[model samples]
Target: MSGSTATTTPQTTIRIPAPAVTALRDALLRPDGRERVAFGYCSRSGNDLLLTEVEQVPDENHRHSSPGSCRPTTACEREFISRCTSRDLHPVFFHSHPFTDTAWFSTLDRQLIDRFRKWLTTLYPDRDLLFGVLGHEEMRIERVTADDSRPVAVDIKGEWELEQPVRPTHTAAPDAPAVDTERFDRHLRAFGEAGQTKLANTHVAVVGCGGIGSILAQTLARLGIGKLTLIDPDEIEVSNLPRLPGCTHGDVGQLKVSAMHQRCWEANPDCDIISIARPVQETEDYLKNADIIVAGVDRVTARYWVNQFAVRHLIPYVDAGTVIETSDADPPQIESMEVYIQTIVPGVTACFDCLDRGDPDQAYRESLDSAEEKAAVERGYIDADIEPEPAVIDLNQLAAAHTVSAVKRLALGTQPPVAFRKYDDVSGDQALLETHPNASCPTCLGNSLALGDSTISSAADQEIATAPLDDAALANPLEQTDRTTRDWFPPAVTAFFASDLAQHPTTDP
Candidate 1:
């Protein structure tokens, strides 16, 4: 378990929030040198399972306890199973082998798991049963089956030190490269060969395929990222030709994602690129599997939705935008031209809500129907035709580069990305500012943080649509999420992302 670096291609992965992992580690790896057990209730999102809650079995609840083996009382097991049933969550059992160097199930473990799996599956026939073992060197999880078991990668979100499961055979070797060493010779130096392989395994989702987003897609492809998911509901326009990479007059009227997909393919033929010609709100299933989200959107509502999704799923988010202000006069005199970049590491750094960047007025207007919007415009409540924001290619490229650099840090496990970066286009000056999570922020704290698919659904979007955006909402943009709770599915519930599972999922595992 403790060896040189390696890479894995596990089909199943379990994403645990930082706090839950910390709690489990502390409880299972006790100083007493005795075996300990904990149970995690998981929520499924595509092939990835998210640990929503952890329950540590106390010493009093153990029937037998020793350094080599331990067993939870039948009553204790039933109690936790009851909790899982109440919440309609899947159960994953974890235990520690304090005396062992590598983690593996013992004979006692096989007996206990067989007994528990039989009892649990009878109650929930379709659900998968998983067992985890934490040894002195590493932790491993396997899905229990009638005949045998298969490895399930354990990914700790918000904590980079703990590892994603690496395939037993693939170790780090700079001289022996998996990718085109000549094409990425420069990359291997900055990121070691293992890091280069990590890039080849990372999946990034670009939420807006306009301006900066188009640049991000092409750049990431050129950087040898293994997968890219491009999402946007817009088609190309004549005016967009200047900002969109690889777009020409002939490509006008085509979907932005399609254009970017073709452009990215030309950049890296080996990289897998998925094009979704729809709003990010309609593409939550795809977003769930993304290793990182790069949002370069201008709409407040779109940004809000992306931020909420990232926070709820504990995915790293890079939100970048350009701001151009002009003074109102006979001629509009330029006031400021700047770009801002925020790297949101859920449960660790500040989120979109922590910065209070949402515009309630715009979001409310966007939610209005055609008739209601026309009435409001006629009543002078809102503008009938809002002028488009000014944009320039140089500013877009600058923002895209900064955003990609943030993703590079996350992919390579080098260091924490900068919390916030600001560049003055006119002054040619840049600054990196530090930011902390807001204790009261609903998006990244107190709620939604690591809630995973529990916080998302078609119903959740309806909540965002119907939320009251009055003075109270203006004070806190995401306060409306308080009303968007999703009920856990019934025993026979269908997979929410079942329809979209045909496409390739993220390759982080």
Candidate 2:
């Protein structure tokens, strides 16, 4: 279906739920001599589009055009108009080619598409028609504008049964031409040709860039995600080298998002990486538009916000964390090291809030969002926590690996939508348990707009020009209030603090 338009050449991202895509592909796949076409409706989210449902024009309702022209039977035509024309839903038409591996529109095919658009205009004059050719193990999508056809990235959330192409198409452009299949040959055996395509089209957004987030980004790149968005505000430190893959001593002071963005690009030059050096809260649009969100933030509040935001946007989410607990026994033995991965499919699975709702620590977790609150905990003002939890690279890596796998499975619909996968190091125990949605959960209840929110725009407004990471802190944040500040105080209030602290600071001696 159609949605709002953006800049012309680079078409908007098309988001289809994983299953919807699988259904569409299955419906379109056919014998070489036979013919078929599939159509569907989709809602919009900002500049991006989505595929909401698909229905095949039954064989009885359409004529086969094997090596020839084909048209819908009168009955099929009438049904299409009745169900789709009046609503302004964008109509996507798919047809198969006799040959496999690759596909291109012929002169007759072009004429047919033009005629179809003309017929569509009689029903909805302003509607734009979308077209696809299901070639051998491959698919090509185009936006038929009044002037020309524009290519758009078709991002399917979760996983899809790929079209087993007769062979891998030359999936590259001339200017940027390079060998594409050699690197993924190993992957092809596991996911098959179709799965690799699905992986290539998946758009994943990672909300943190620390140990867990960095590992997740790298793994997703290696997994063949075509596009990735990284959202984080922290910079790398010497201490980060222990766990973050691809981050070396040379990158010690770079922005975590920027460094990891480079690492992913170097891994898969085919993938488009959008690096946002900012907190997820400041950049909600990325989370909303991504096919899936991999939550890797350190703060509980950030995770809480991501769950709600993801639910509101109907995006799949994978969140994970690791904790190490030790006992004050005679030998001060390591009591346990636990890693947990939580995956959620909005409206389908139990969201993070649903799980937190039943836990007594929810209130405490909710309150620990602020730097001051964290400082208080470190100072023992909060009794529940002795201090900040220690971060280990191996633990973060273990949890990230599981979370990334879950992220892939969530997109593929192979795993339970709401499940907690836990690993205990000391006890050598592993469990994956299904989680139930809260009966009174508001988000699950308010599934009024499934892929219907187009008001939230991308991060253009929230985007800050990403600068190369400086070795030093660059400037005191208090001193650079005019340049940047998220200090939780108004400028005037900060001024008051400056004066108050200055007046009382002689006691520091």
Per-structure clash totals for the candidates: 1, 11
| Candidate 2 Cα misplacement greater than 4 A, ranges | 1-44, 48-179, 357-386, 411-418, 446-509
Estimate every model's Cα lDDT from 0 to 1: 0.79, 0.67
lDDT of 2 by residue, 111-154 (tens): 88787766665556555578876555555667676566666666
RMSD of each predicted structure = 10.3, 13.0
Candidate 1 has its poorest 10 consecutive residues by lDDT at 167-176
Q: All candidates' TM-scores?
A: 0.81, 0.57
Q: Which candidate is the best by TM-score?
A: 1
- lDDT assessment of candidate 1: 0.79
* Model 2, C-alpha of 175: deviation from truth (Å): 15
Give the runs in model 1 whose Cα sits over 4 Å from its true position: 1-9, 161-177, 426-439, 454-509
